[model samples]
Target: MEIDQPYGTPERDVMCVMVCGKLVDIDLHGRRYDGLVGLIRAGGTDMSEAMVAASAAWEYARYDSDQTMPGFRAAACQQGRGL
Candidate 1:
């Protein structure tokens, strides 16, 4: 990802997408926006269909990428650390 203002905050703009060293898709989210709240709002959903749509989009995007199935106890090891 290209850093437009890396020193100010670690907020990232999806500059590009790559799978196994090849760019496959493009993102249209614009730059120059406050990111923390926007990031949360990106995943923020209330309706069931909204959640399904988001999950489907993620699965389609990462369909060709490496996949991992997390174990049941994986959550207790790291709570919100990766978040």
Candidate 2:
């Protein structure tokens, strides 16, 4: 996965599915969201479907992720800071 620092929010990172990798704009159906709240709103009636969609988007982004990018860190790295 990758860390996506949103424009004008250096202190915060958007970890949503569609923003999982570098080429996030291609992830699918979530660029309109702001965060969990937005996603929940997008869910309207069924939150599960929204979650499934988010996961799919994450998987899609991860599938073509370029590990060399500065924000592209392995899931394993999230387990250990290594510092």
Clashes of each: 0, 0
lDDT by residue (1-83, candidate 1, tens digit) is 22453321221312111123343333334454444211212223222122223221122233223232132124423453211
Candidate 2 lDDT for residue 51:
30
The top-ranked prediction according to lDDT is 2
Whole-model lDDT per candidate: 0.26, 0.30
lDDT (Cα) of model 2:
0.30
Q: Write the per-residue lDDT of candidate 2 for residues 18-78, one digit (tens) a residue.
A: 2343332222334424532122232232222333333221322333333332232343245
RMSD of 2: 13.6
Model 2 CA deviation exceeding 4 Å by range: 1-43, 56-83
Q: Locate the minimum summed-lDDT window of 10 residues in model 1.
A: 9-18
TM-score of 1: 0.19
